[model samples]
Target: MECGIFHTPYMRPGRTDKETFEYSMMLAKAADSFGYRDFMVGEHGMQAWENIPNPELLIVAAAQVTERMRFAPMAHIVPLHNPSSLAVQVGYTSQLLQDRYFLGVGAGSWENEAVLRGQPGDLSEAHPRLLEGLEVMDKVWRRQPFTHEGQFYKAAWLEAGIEAGSVDHHDAFDLKDGEEYHALADHSPYGGADGLEIAITGLSAGSPSHVLAGQRGWTPVSFYGGSTLLRSQWDVYSAAVEARGDVPDGSRFKVARDVFVAKTDEEAKEQAKNGALGHAWSKYLMPVYKKYRILQGFIDDADVKVDINDVDLDYLADHVWLCGSPETVMAKIERTFEQTGFRYGQIAVNTHDALDDPAPWVESLRLFATEVVANIEVAGSKSPVHEFA
Candidate 1:
């Protein structure tokens, strides 16, 4: 599969926001230069670990520096903003990037974020609100005069026009009527005469959002879950798409995984255990996974019966993470594909803090992009391997 980078970027403690953003830019530049397909960043309003509140700003900046890498908000929480406003902003972003942007939407998952945004901490209405918001955004992007009276939002778009010489309108160029002047007449996506490419993140097994993605024919992005969870998600999504008389394509599916590569397997394991990846897991991700009881997926995927408490860095290195030498990592990737029967188009590398020592992190990304990727035969497989057959 083609490679990509997914930056949730759990920055180390005491890092300034500027430093964090610059670090992300560094990774973006590296990924672009390394020939990655896309770069995605998570959007979070309150969490310091996942600190980017507006991923669009980063995407815009990265677009300037990168040549061909596409960008997306690993997801923009749909329940937090006015759908029309977000639609317009995303449309503009897509226009600025010129085919380098895709939209990823989700309901706010964190209760604290929901509470901070003046909603119930339980987020009871978040899913329903997300559904309505997505519908409103779709309508808004159609560029038709329409009104929406939904459960969580009320919005309308009225068509407005400007005549060539009406109401003392100043034509800066003073061009003839037949001359083409590129104006923001349509706020739809750039080259979105068809439709904007939308993706949805699915974390938990059998997530309904993934089902929605299948029904809408949007990309289904699976978080760094183990093979079992990935298979479950694909099964759910494929079933949904099949029910709707659509064939599920694996190329539209993205799978995120924590990856680290070194000269040797032992070195990679040690670095992953003691370096930024380890720090992120020990300090940030593990805690959240424990709180949300997300560690069971790993536990279930392991060969031996392991308690959630025992799911440490070593356990992860052996079972969940794709950390090793290039050869080992490639084998792991191929194994995952063989097990799941789905060759994902994009292998989104789950990135962590590289502030402490950027060399190893950068090197790992380089090896994965250059060596491992070059060695893989199924890098561009668009369909499920033997699944449909």
Candidate 2:
């Protein structure tokens, strides 16, 4: 039961983008000091409400402040860019981090992002495009010349300049051919590695990406989903892994949940219920669900008679959020594992603008690490909790 943090950099009423950026980095540094396993930042292109156009840049800055925490761009919206370009960027960043970076790729999901890019604001085409983009990246990173033909993208005899003495003069420079002949691989950012860790996210339960994860041994992550949906995703992932003659393990499965913690259960609930967590669902998420007519996708029970139009903050808090004192929060996570069969799973705490004042937010994060994580780790050993100064 490892813990990680994912920040969405949610914009609130009065907080400037600068303030949000600083606050997010502050929390990430705290996670570093607390010995969390990893820190991940998400990328969004057009949505002003949740803005952080290039999470990779932020991860680079964070790497300077943290000593051991691994960083990832939670999911670079794959359909928006050329895979070849993204692959080089990712490869360069991985080498810069000295292999401390992981890649998470997904189809662009937010409606504004898709429409801004002149594509239908739907998931239908994005999935195949995402697959093609990843395939191109794979071919490009193999350190050789390659070609790809796909419905969404294609490459014709592009060379990586990785093979010894295979450098092309055109790839060397834009200057008149008199310029010094140099290979891109001669100055390759990744010293010699072929690739880095790869992960895929499923926008929907049991998506084709889950099968890809199983086939490729890539980690699978689901964002802010209920246990029922997560279990369905794991079922699909496990079946695919078995089909490929590999054993599936929960160690690599990650589930992100909206979490807040406090010194006491009552205080925690009061803060979450009255602060940004409450407002985020009521004002932003649920409204979007209703507008898109996809509220059913988020609800825990499909048979229940409920109106998506009438869904409110309380319903979301009870079903989706993991909020309480350390003990209560740990219990909820344990139950999530039991229900979803994520026995060796990692818990990614999804952070947003939970409060206007950053004090409670910082305190809540500290408590989660010092108390909830300490207790959960010891419970497995049937040993006494480690004393902290």
Candidate 3:
């Protein structure tokens, strides 16, 4: 139960970016004061709730203000990035942050990033495109040259370079109409440099992508938005890993989800029930999350609609989120462990309009970490784990 802070800098109707930045800074500074172990930020280009549209820049700002916190993206849309270039920037950031770097990458949702800029949001055609992009990035960081020829993308006779204390964007682009769209290189070390871990949020362990990676011995950062929903998903994934004849030593799976913790059972429910987060539910995730729920083993069909109003704060507060007073929050968290068997309870505590109230959010983080985390035992494991046993 390693409690941490997750921020989604939302632009509430009345606030300016400067005001928002000021408030977000307050939250980060508070996380520092409160002695939190990690602070993660997210990236989304179009949503109002997604203010830190570029989490890497935000990470630098957070690192400058805080003394120590393992910083990462809840995940980045890796497929959209030039992997070689991503490697350099992340490597520099990781070194600058002095090894407190934990990089989380995802193929991502919302193909609309390119769509909004007069392009297409078709990951159906882009994932394989970006997958090869990552290959070039992997080799380039190790001072190697690699060529690529894959559907939707290609690179030939290329190399990239890195320098001490700076990110020099080397041979790192496949330009179309004078705009660099992807990477062309011989070798890429996007996740290998600095011992960075590669993680994937998937449909399940038995899903071809997850199982394929597992078969080749890549430990994935397995994610589930809710615990109960993923219990069966984890079972399937872990079983696939074990059955693959190449399961990694220890459980190399991480269950990362959004969680909120509070002091009193009553307060916890109120904190999470409806205002900011439920607003978020209404705005973004609920509309799209249902399909994944079914794909992840929760429901048979994907008619996903969550009436935010219908969500019982108390039931969800106690059951899903690690929320309650110190005594109660701790108890629920322990129960979460017993039930989920997940070592990593990655808590994305921040939500819609939440960062706007910097002071209280920070205080809640401190209360959860000091009061609840101190009383609990960290389920011991290094690999991202899916199930409890």
Candidate 4:
């Protein structure tokens, strides 16, 4: 299995923007040094506890300090911005990073986030807009003139332009506000720019959004789930892919986990209880989820039902978190994959404030790379997998 780091950049108390940003970048840089596959950052505007408004900027900054590791914004909220503008920015970003980045798009998730971003739609309304917005972006990235008129968004295609040095051509495209184009003419030798890998984040088990991912042959990233929940998501994605006559490959899937590691299981659990990881969920996340009425998933799992009021660090450490020594955590990960049959998917570990101490956190990442990942064996596919075969 390929391993990667997924940073949410949850701003915690006692840390300034500059400190948090610098520390987060340090994690990304460390991931690169440790030879992780990819580094993904998240975005959450107006949520002071999770301050990154544009993850792309973080990716750009991380790119300068690291080499070889692919960088991505875990998602760009689709409904809050013009799709055409998003297309241009992402396309340019891909080019700037030498096609070493992927785009993760999602409908606005939280109602509060939507309100904060000036998009006050509910989740139901955001879904259709996410679909339409992606359609618009896809059309624009084809490097050809096209027009789109959908329920949520409209785009008029602009023809490709002449070389930057050429004075013969006038820019004919009327771009969306803050959008610009940079591409050779359609007939130029370099006309076919590098295509981007687009992945969609499936936040809930069996989300209908997975169907879009399947139809488009994009990667399905399961956000924060154990084996059972992630398996349900894969089932949904696989069925949708099969419906379109495509093979379902587990290697293309991604699973996100919240992890913290130390020299031993006891030490790890203790640190998790006392560290920034503990502070974030207890103080900021739980309260917001409770206030917003979105704690059902975290509170009620398939095998357990715990009252939100009674949930604590001990409960979380046992149920949701992967906190232990390298060997201990590796065993848990092995069990998760064994249960879910996630053979070759990217096992993405969510970044925690556990790294704020620097020594233990860095050691954990290094140990994960050296001791855990080195010993894990992936079940490789011998042939193109068909439905249920």
Each model's TM-score?
0.89, 0.84, 0.72, 0.83
| Candidate 2 C-alpha lDDT tens digits along 1-389 | 56777776566646666776787778888777766666888888667667788888888888999887788888898888788788778887888897678888888678778777777877577877787887787666665667677887877544533443446652433435655433445222354434567777775667677788898888887774556667778889999999989988877877677788888877888788788777777667667655544456556442344566666666555555678888888887787767776664566777778545777877877777678866664223211113222
Ranking by TM-score: 1, 2, 4, 3
lDDT of 4 by residue, 83-152 (tens): 8888777777776786568888888677787776566546566887888888787777775778787887
Query: Model 3: runs farther than 4 Å from truth?
Result: 9-16, 117-122, 156-194, 202-223, 232-254, 282-285, 294-309, 312-315, 341-348, 381-389
| Comparing 1 and 3 on lDDT, the stronger one | 1
Index of the highest-TM-score prediction: 1
Question: What are the per-residue Cα lDDT tens digits for candidate 3 across 1-389?
Answer: 44455565545655666666666667777766665555667666766556666787878887888776667775666666766567677667766675666666656666677666444666564456446666665655665556766654454434433322244655444435765333443223334553665545454434444554455444454445545544554555566667876443323554444455565667666766654554555556554555455322322211343443344434345444455677876665555555566644344355446654444445566776566555555544321111111
How far is each candidate from the true structure, as Cα RMSD in Å? 5.2, 4.8, 8.4, 6.8
CA displacement after TM-score superposition, residue 136 of candidate 4 (Å)? 1.2
Better of 1 and 4 by TM-score: 1
Candidate 2, superposed: residue stretches over 4 Å from native: 13-16, 156-182, 186-195, 289-311, 377-389
Select the stronger candidate by TM-score from 1 and 3: 1
Sort by lDDT, best first: what order?
Answer: 1, 4, 2, 3
Candidate 1 local lDDT, 226-324, one digit each (tens): 677788889999999999999888777788888999999999999999998898998888877777656777677667768888787898887778899
Q: Show the colliding residue pairs in model 1.
A: 1-379
